[model samples]
Target: MTLTKSTFTGLVLEYDSGIVPPPYSHVFRLALDWSKGDMIADLVLHYTEREDLSEEEILDEGFTLNDDYNYQGPLNSVWIKPLQQLYEKTRWTNKDIEEGGITVTPLEKGKDEGVKIPSDQEEWQLMAQDLIQAIYETVKKEAPLKVNYRSVQGDEIIDCSLTVHFSNREVIFEIAGKSRQINWEYAIQLMKIVFTPDYHYELAKEEAGKKRGAYIDCGDGFWHELGKGVVNIDPSFDAVSKIRKGFDELISE
Candidate 1:
């Protein structure tokens, strides 16, 4: 197959449970943006042929047998109509479909190419640790709390046994895993105070679980730790009151 100017997108699906029955098993969707025209239509019509494959048959032919490339053969078994309704107008062209694992490059006459990683692993990890420390201190002094940490990338979610220590108006949260660290600083900033008793009671009820998982989990865990007196928070009520007083002073002036 002589693939001219083309763009390919890769999508990876990693199901944690591995054996999820029915619809839950369907994990991810990746679209390859084909630059020229509808490749799917060509495949249907048998228009393109593997005519001039070079010595490296696999590379020149532009196909791979790797699981990543195939991604369980087109997600057809699971994707159904209504949910999977793709009309001709809405249907993906050849350029839009991609195997989960294959990296496709597009050719263009005058296109600028640039690459950047979202964030450095080391920096994010350090920030995660700092946030963890802040959570620990705030809970310890104001609320009194204990916590365990867990993180995941790809399909592996591993637990990190974390403990916090504070000194010189500074706090630290430490964990052993890889050379890479967690983004604890942002985690701490994003933490919210939760009432554990309230959370437990709410979790027992069916109403709470219906909302999104992230929202409920964050709220429940945060308050549960708070109500249990397990962690301390800076800017306690007293501190907030003082800040308000200062603001009021400034306004009066």
Candidate 2:
């Protein structure tokens, strides 16, 4: 939309990069002086009156305003691919999991086609740790982390919500309106089993147990832990058993 110099004053244009969810909008301000034949463009990200992402991150990853005087929009395209990758990598949400396990996908897939992992295992772990910490904080300060994990039951597929309430050194699973608590240490271990990159879950055709038809299993560590138990694992057998039951009952309606 073109306007006279005076009309363009105080004009702000919003671009929906489709990077973040709703209630978050990133906008661009155009200081156009058509009469004087001068214009300046600046990109700004905000949610309501505040910005959830740091200014530094946005500037570093998001596209800057065009210096070309004739430049025009098409702004709402998927332009913030870098930022999208960052969000998908460093965050764990309901979208990251399916059938009670993490989805297998590339973490980086950065600008450089040859680049993949952001360095080494330590860096990957650090990013994972940050996501885990954010989950803990949300559970502690905000609300319980609620995830709707999908279940495959023979010919039926259903999604069920699992709520994790973290407090002190333990976490509780509220399932079927009943709550079961386990040590934070054990919770972390289970998360690793579900979120590890080595696993590629495929629903088994044959039923293994009452809920096995719904909860698919494929990861090696998952089976090893169930078979003879890991050599170094000295888990509370009763608590582990209870955790299994809770997960199985997740799809129970």
Candidate 3:
């Protein structure tokens, strides 16, 4: 069957009576507004059983609940099942609605170009810290060395120190006061940051040739290179060679 706003309204109404106690039965009203492509469902429970109650008393006794879901593709194909599940599983809480109580499908097919969800800074910081730690541990496994790395937390750049034990294959991170197993893959990924300028230049050149922007994930995070002014510059061979030599010396020790 074709899914429309009315279909959603009917589904919500079907589950409204289940939301409250029996005494509050038949007092729930469900409203759906779809004027803007986005669907909003508003559920209000009124004190309808007590006809003798004054309008003010009724207003005081009623409560409202709201949920929003985005719509873009065919409703029947994309949202009907999740909508039904959301209605069935919704519950009232002392605070705001519990997370995961509502599930909305993303508009993959209809998403507008150039529209992007902003990244969570805190989450990105945490990921960066983990990657740095993992890389430190991996290098420490190869040799006895003292490595210094920096991670960004909020507006602060925190410096970290690591002591690598080649015999036991353990890396002790002083900042976190913890030790983790070596992760070689993560170490290689972090090494890319040391050569980022080189890769960025190459990427910019490639994008200039293609006349489009290039998206790159050099194991750390996503980076974009737009084709605007592409300058042919040599990758930082000296810096990369120095880093390799230093690592080799550490392993020899």
Candidate 4:
């Protein structure tokens, strides 16, 4: 759907509702002029759900409810505006898959492109919006999930919001609820490309000394590079390494 001025605000509101309390649902509201008279704001929400609910139930709530609120930030508007522009100029196709349902054409890289953006405005917006929707769905699906997180120093978790525009980079992440921690596989996915191997090595060493060392620390570029090719561990690399000699070879090779 083409996001008009009114619709734009509604999108933000809907997304925001999924994170913070009502009347302050949105964590970030991003507005962009794009040299035009009108403005567009991309809103983002962060939520954490429990194992007791269904995805449908989560959607109905429209927000994640956890005992702790660690994932808090001013949603960066600068990132959203450019993403909107990039989406406007791109082309993306969706097709029904043999497996079932529909699949989005994976984003591709262009040669010397002008800031590789999302394929289509509507489709991209759908992802940002659907991230909340997906979480709601996952909550319903009863997937085994947990999170471990760190946040600003405070006695209580505080809700936050951010509005950005024309920024160079955008980042999105969340904190796991208390007693909930990130699965090593999923955490690795998020951390792979964002951090360097050396950084990840250091993080691994640091986390190894902790009680929950079963979770891999994909800090730095580890989050971003996960999809490309990298090994991940649930408990610890050393434990996994004993199970497979290829682990050392893979890292060095």
Candidate numbers sorted by TM-score from highest down? 2, 4, 3, 1
Which 10 residues in a row give candidate 1 its minimum summed lDDT?
38-47
lDDT against true structure, model 4:
0.30
- TM-score, every prediction: 0.18, 0.26, 0.19, 0.25
Error of 4 at 105 (Å): 18
lDDT by residue (85-170, candidate 4, tens digit) is 53455554443222212122211221111122233444544445433333333334332222222122234432111111112132
Extract clashing residue pairs from model 2: none
Clashes of 1: 39
Model 1 RMSD, rounded to 1 decimal: 22.7
**Candidate 1 local lDDT, residue 237:** 41
Those runs of model 1 whose alpha carbons end farther than 4 Å from true positions after fitting are: 1-146, 151-155, 175-188, 193-198, 201-253
Q: Each candidate's root-mean-square deviation in Å?
A: 22.7, 20.0, 24.4, 15.8
lDDT, model 3:
0.34
By TM-score, how accurate is candidate 1? 0.18
For candidate 3, write residues 19-63 as lDDT tens digits.
Answer: 443234343333333334444444443433445545565456553
TM-score of 4: 0.25
Looking at model 2, report the run of 10 residues with the lowest lDDT sum. 107-116
1-253 per-residue lDDT for model 2 (tens digits): 2222223222222222234432333332221111223222233333332246456544565423321112222221111232234424543333421111112122121111121222233433333333333333433434544433334456665434444443223456554456666554455555544443222233223333334232323322122222222221345344334434555654342
Over 92-204, each residue of candidate 1 has an lDDT whose tens digit, in order, gives 22442222111222223323232111123233223223322333343343232223333333554433322223211222333444332234332233232222113343333
Task: For residue 19, give model 4's deviation from the true position in Å.
Answer: 21
